[model samples]
Target chain A: MPGGPVNDFLDQVETCVPALRRYARALTRNADLADDLVQDCLERAIARRGLFRPTGSVRAWLFTILLNIYRNSRRAAGRRGETVNLDSVAEPASPAPQPGHIALAELARAIDALPIEQKEVVLLIALEGLPYAEAATILSIPLGTLMSRLGRARSALRLATGVTAEPHLRTVK
Target chain B: MSAVTHDDLMAYADGQLDPGRVGAVEAHLAANPDAASEIALMRRQSDALHALFDPVAAEPVPARLRARRIAAAQRQRRGRSWSWAVAALVLLSLGVGGGWFARPLFEAPAASAVLIADAINAHTVFVAENRHAVEVGRDDSAHLASWLSNRLDTTLGLPDLSAQGFALVGGRLLPGEPQLGGRAAQLMYEDAAGARITIYVTAALPDRQPAAQLASLDGAEAFYWANARITCTVVGTLPAERMQAVSQAVYGQLTDGDVSAPRYRS
Candidate 1:
């Protein structure tokens, strides 16, 4: 019920687009579908500006709306027997060059192989840097469930990538 | 110090552990190398995941993703005319005049407050109708309950208020504030005297916090409460005691022994 100028809402939403696009891209693994999802989310939020509460942070609220739309579309796509094309998944332009680091492509596949529930929890917490409480709220899951999912997801990724500690090489900062 | 648990380890890796607990976790890790290595591995996974996807956040957003442009386009498509704007401005002035007198009371009630107002508004609009008071009538109460339950994404049953001298008159779905689920179901009941009351229900709000509130507008009074399952508001114009009795009956049946239902904020 925090009524405000529409322009202000739009401005806040605009600042969030880059992060939304990033999260969507990680979830969908395809750039075109990711942008499309973000666009749909932005449209929905803009249309329902009056529905947003003034008490909560707009960022968390926007993320919740995005996740809801994402799940609905996924369900619809599932019924139609649609699957994301693995070949279309985009890779990051630059990956960290740490000694004995897991290959970025391999890690991406490991993440994609995670169960949808675990993938959502991991990406929201790891990639979006959302607090556990906020991420749980966005996913509509209890905090305990979110932590468990994160635990299972980290183990699954570690097993998939086969990461073991390599001898530390001192590097200049 | 209490022993560190797996949850604490994960929380520490995620940077969610409180600063006071950081020393304990670090001490535990130093004494336990295996635990230290496991935490290190978790951090590595988080870093690699970031390496794989963080660049996307830095990429230039496409022109189509602009929020302002999308909003403008949406407005153009809706094609709202000027008269509606003029009328809204007039109403805004009237609201300001009335609201100024009650400014202390208008300090922006919580989301439940907004929902109660919406429920009352819906009640007032439809309770006056004769033929179209409800989309699904009492004869189909069973189906009405199921349909609204599905739409609202929560289990709902039609509370039998006959003991309170009101019979199920039917219910209809209405657009609700999206923040409180985008849809609401309004069930109308008419007493033998022809007076009617409505119970407005929506799926639990985002926080799922228990809340209750009462508000009166234009002679209509609404008693609203939200538990973990759903939010229900009973709206009517009956005398205060009669209204309270009806609200209590509806609350008892709908809450299903939720003994800790929060009291309405005055």
Candidate 2:
């Protein structure tokens, strides 16, 4: 096989790796497991390079594969009775922040509590900065469904964070 | 001009609204404190999500996640599989050329095992030979299909796997074990990535019993199935799911109108 397409494909995959790792980490909340997920996703994508069309964005395609692999792993884990303990993982180390800052740990826990559907929708749009159209496409849902999931996820986060007292806290710069 | 909906407010918060509509949404946000507060809370949630996860993208990526390295390793593995196939072919030629001297070394492996080995060996040997991958090319697919069918004495059709991203590279006949059948037809297919797979088919074994087997030898994977009329094995180094998809497509086409045969799978 010629090296040109393979090289190009690898380069495309390389560009998305960091973002993939970030999304995987956000979803799994374990560094090692998240990396493992990314490795598996990359392997699958490379092996199936023939099926990937050049017209579509490689980033979206990689994200789609990553999400599918994540879902399958979660399903397998569910069957095997594996449970993740968010409390057990070491907390992210950040020094005390200014007043009105959202407690990172509280927000993390709130995100973890979201339903998987809403969680995927929220993170794809919010954390990954994907357009609503692309996020909906990646999730294989209608645009309306994507909107509802985002709405519900944000509401759940707001409730769980107990930030109802003052909703207009502009992010602490 | 029109009453702004909740979707419009959320779209504004998500930065997805059209530029022309941005002014209308902003005017509405200023006029309605509740709408403004709702959009603010949504934006805050997005900002919090970013704060929680954006650092991950900046952290040094692990070595295992490097795509170039992964692709290189995969290429190395494919090369290794071909080497093993070549070695197997050398051993098989020894068994054939030396006859009685090497009989013990080649004593009838399981029929499926022999078939899978032959399929993979043929796949490795011919796939690398760009100029002479097959005796007949896909351009003469009609003649190739019929000639192979006549040679094997079983009805065979050219399996179209274009849907699965593989196009038939055509086929050639090869010698086979007398115990099962004296001849086999090796049909090759190539995908856009130039990855090649082969379907090795022959007349059924004497007992004509249905059998299915999946084997991963070296790096290549093989899916073999036998029916009353014919035996088919698909061999490739593709990942399991992709291999399954190609094998499934091949099975569907070749087994058309034959219900007795159990579906072949990976």
Candidate 3:
């Protein structure tokens, strides 16, 4: 908090940039546009730093910024109805590995195919490693909602990625 | 053969189990093959999820994503915006003051200071402009004199200083800060030696009273006066005696031989 609201706001945004970028990337599924979303989010955050000081955690504050910007773009796109999603989840290059479980690429597609709400929570908690409480706070949902979303997301991912038996399950310890 | 709930199994797979609660869960899972299989699927799911996105957290953060730089840019942008607001406010005050005083325009104690500052600033900006040495050329001295006199409501006459080895180099109209007439006409005079002096004049303040004083400010000597007609500040770096002589000559003629005019003594 040294150097007042300006500095504190900056510090907060800085600490959250990476997470914000990752979330944007997951939401938009495009690296460049994700960063664009991040940049716009930062711009709004900087412009309205004064509004946040006594309110949200800097992380939640930033996520709120990113989420609003994302939603607005989505709404605008709805108006245009021309979304190509041209960059939806590029396939990573790698030789295919073992079976009995869902292949990683198929799993990725499954995660991508989940509705936005489910995908957002699963990525925030399971992927981004944000706690359920923090994810709930960031998403403005009750913890139960966050838990249900996570549960449904995992169930959807299992169905989509293939829930066939895999021997590695016993070695988790 | 035990009762390990799905919530507990999911929590354990996601690393949410308390250390103390883990032993009991592990014992229960070890004894139940079906329960163990369910726990295994959950662990595999968590692992697959991590395999997909954890590399992101491990990747070298791009420069654009660097927390410090983003923060720095954001802070700078915010500070710049706020400082701009402050600057606009100050400029607004200056503009309002410029309109309010509306008389000789600048208040007295402050008049000399402001005039000296303007004299210095104007000298700096235009002394280098050869073709535009004066806003109104000396050749059009009549217009320069009349226009300024009307604007300031003072009887202003351009002095012919040829008798004193100096010639009117011309004059320019300048916007002065409010306290100092808000509008000023700077009359530049140069001697045979290229030595220069300027007389800054403004309209008779609304008070219509006359006041005269002298001071040395920031390397410039200023002789100033306010009359029912106008306020004039004479500024230069000449010696005290030279300044007095120039003031006497400027006052003598610019005042148009008004017998009640003040005398010359530093």
Candidate 4:
């Protein structure tokens, strides 16, 4: 067999790594599990090789694969009753930002609390930095559906984290 | 722009609006603080979310997530799988067990194997392409490079293959095994004999190890390798000697003394 496709796959995975980790992080709410998820995703992708290819952008294709793997693993873990806590793993953005709303720990929990749909939209757009078009394609939803999910995700975070107060941190950009 | 709907406003906030409508949205925003606040709120949310997560992108990607490693793991996997297949064949020969009886255990072709095959297959198909070949012309190398690079999420360098008498024609990113790496880039090069060669590049696997392998397939001689930086497959339908020369030239130039190049036997 030619080594070309393997090379191509490797290169593609390299680019998708950050986004995968980010999405994994968002999904599992555990950096270690998220990385494990990413590793599993890559292993499965490489091991499976060329069989899973479907027509369309590979970005969407890869995301779909990763999402499926993540869901399946989660289901398997649930069945096994392997439970773990994520509270101790939480880290703040800065030494001291404020007492309440701007606290990143609170925000992380809020994000963790979002409905899976809203969470998926936020990660695809904000965390993964995927284009709306690509993210919508990956989610297999209308662009409008994606936007609503994103909108709801943000609103929920603002309420959940008690960050309702305007930042007053206006940016001229 | 005339009393833009919520969708239109959302699109504008996301920076997805057409240029013609941008001014109109701005006009609307200036007139409506309420709408502006909504947009501002969305932007802030985006900013905060980015603040919370974008760092993951810059975090020195873990070695386990490296492309080179993933590719290496994949190659090893293929070898192991082939051996497993051989063992299964042996078992069947002996009529000892039912390992072959299970379909899911050994039936489906792995994505990596298929992608590598497809990349080689596509390389053969298009390397023979002549006039009106590549979707993007080589003259627009800068655009093509940037576009494909952005799509593939890795730096794309058009290796100077001129010394081998193969001038770059252009390249197009193709979707490959999403499981393997998700995307593939095909760059076409033409030589004086009207012969062609293609260099296929993809993101490294999670393992990011290197490999040296050569596979002759479908009238094309393919020299493929993986490295920390990228996985490149050079494919063309040239005579074995000519293909080796081309692959060697490509390996030499693209590596640019950054690392040792792979040697192929056949």
DockQ of each: 0.28, 0.26, 0.11, 0.25
Listing every candidate in turn, what is its Cα RMSD in Å to the true structure after a full C-alpha superposition? 22.0, 17.2, 20.0, 13.3
lDDT of 2 at B55: 83
Tens-digit lDDT track for model 3 on A1-173? 12455555665676677778777876776677888888888877766666776554788778877887888888888897834453455565656545545467777778768988898888877666776777788788997788788878888877776564445541221
Each model's chain A TM-score = 0.85, 0.87, 0.83, 0.79
Ranking by TM-score: 2, 1, 4, 3
lDDT of 3 by residue, B1-266 (tens): 34556666666877876677788789988888767876777667767766765565565555445443444344333344443343234324323223322332333234334444455545545655777878887788888887877666556778777776778889878776675467888899888887788888876555555445454433556566555566677767787668777876776666653423433211
lDDT of each: 0.77, 0.77, 0.66, 0.67
lDDT of 1 by residue, A1-173 (tens): 11246646776897899899889989999888888899988888888989998787788888888888889998999988867767765554656646556667778898889988999899998888899998988888999999999989988887777665442632323
Better of 1 and 2 by DockQ: 1
Ranking by DockQ: 1, 2, 4, 3
Report, to 2 decimal places, the DockQ of model 3.
0.11
Show what share of the native A-B interface contacts model 4 retains.
0.40
All candidates: TM-score:
0.54, 0.55, 0.50, 0.54
* Tens-digit lDDT track of model 1 for B79-195: 323322432343243232332223223222356555765776677579879999999999998899989988988778899998899999999998877666889999999999999
Task: For residue B81, give model 3's deviation from the true position in Å.
Answer: 9.2
Worst 10 residues of 4 chain B by lDDT: B257-266
Write candidate 2's Cα lDDT for A139-169 as tens digits: 8999999998888888888778766525355
The per-residue C-alpha lDDT of model 3 at residue A43 equals 72
Task: Give the higher-TM-score candidate: 2 or 3.
Answer: 2
